[model samples]
Target: MLCFGFTFLYVPMVLLIVYSFNYSKIVPVWGGWSTRWYTVLFESEEVWAAITLSLKIALMNATFATMLGALAGLALVRFKSFRGRTLFGGMISAPLVMPEVITGLSLLLLFITLGQLIGWPTNRGITTITIAHITFSMAYVAVIIQSRLTGLDQSLEEAAEDLGAKPFRVLIDITLPLLAPGLLAGWLLAFTLSIDDLVIASFVSGPGANTLPMLIYSRVRLGLRPDINAMATIIIIVVAIGVCLAGWLMMRQERQRQRDMQLASGDNIKQD
Candidate 1:
């Protein structure tokens, strides 16, 4: 079953990667092996522009989403009860449940109204797209941090407070450190969502701000293109590398944390 599931998931991606190297412009014909498409991809200014725009939006969206999400999660888990807590939670979660079309339409209207009123963001573009991405991605990040907080033991935090640490200090020294893995995961998830987004971004983006997804989507809709396959392969390679790097860093941190806890335990036992 495991093998079946893996095959189901990755077989198409592998085929796409293989087809990227095909010599023919006509897809599925397989005229032979060639790297011409990759050459074309590198030389295309529009493709490079799209890649830059996508990366720029993804980075900004991930950073803002992670920050807001950590705070929201802290509130949801630590505060327990507060005025307007239910309303706040509903707003935070609304994007998660809402249809992408609806979300995109609503954001489009919002930007239009804002531009008319303030005369700022006078046109829809990267700023509007980034805002839309951040709106949805923030919810995903919050959910991640909230789940991590749910499983957390709060004794360390209480002990830190008892030992003369202020609330902010406890957060910085204990809570945030413990939440690091979740935060990193949330950031990566947010980045992926922002980069992969087509619907919401399409609604909000204007001329001169084509993201990679949008560009690829447009080409895919028209017809089969081997350059598209090459683009996907490159993205897959970059994402796979990033995931492996993150996993390794997380494991290293976890091991170090466990070792420190053991050392601290031994010291306490000796003192006692």
Candidate 2:
């Protein structure tokens, strides 16, 4: 059942990729295969501009979301008994559960209100889209980091303190190293979400704020374009490669940690 489910989900994407090289723009048809569409995609300045904008927003959103989420995760995990903790956690995660349309509308209203009151974010553009992306992205990031924090060995932190390391130094040297994998995972997820966003971005984005997805959406609505297929194929390949790389890195890190533990145990036995 699980395999069937996975296959069902991926088959359409696989078909799309296969059809990307098809010479017939009508799709699901075979004409003599050609890479011409990819060539066109590379040469299109408009497409390139959208891609650049998306990448920039994704990078910035990921950085800010990851940092904010990490701090929130720490607070939630380490200080569970704080006043209004429940309300705070609920507020942090509200965006994730809210409908995209609702979230977008709310953000737009907030932007309007802020503009009238404070004169910031004067008009929607990259900043508005990025803020919306970060709003949701950070919720997922916080959840990931909090899960990792919950599973971490608290004794390691205590040992750092016993060794005369200050609290901040212990956090930097001990906690941060152990949490590196979680942070990296959270950052990657946040980046991917930001890059692929559409609905919220659509509502928040103003004139001249089209992202790659928005550009694609506009072109797709007109009719099938071979260039779109080529772009989709490239994105699928890139996403697959990234997933494989992340899995490999995580496995390698886990193996190294286990080996270190074994070596430490061996040294302790020898000293005894």
Question: TM-score of every model?
Answer: 0.89, 0.89
lDDT of 2 by residue, 1-272 (tens): 99999999999898888888888767656887888889989999999999999999999999999999999999898786999999988888887789999999999999989999999888899999999899999999999999999999899999999999999999999999999989998999999999988999999999988999999999999987889999999999998998898789889999999999999999999999
For model 1, residues 139-221, the per-residue Cα lDDT tens digits are 99999999999899988899999999999999999999999989989999999999899999999999888999999999899
Task: Indicate the worst ten consecutive residues by lDDT in candidate 1.
Answer: 115-124
lDDT of each: 0.94, 0.92
Model 1 off-target regions past 4 Å? 1-8, 246-272
Per-candidate Cα RMSD to the true structure, in Å, reads 2.9, 2.6
Clashing pairs in 2: none
What TM value does model 2 have? 0.89
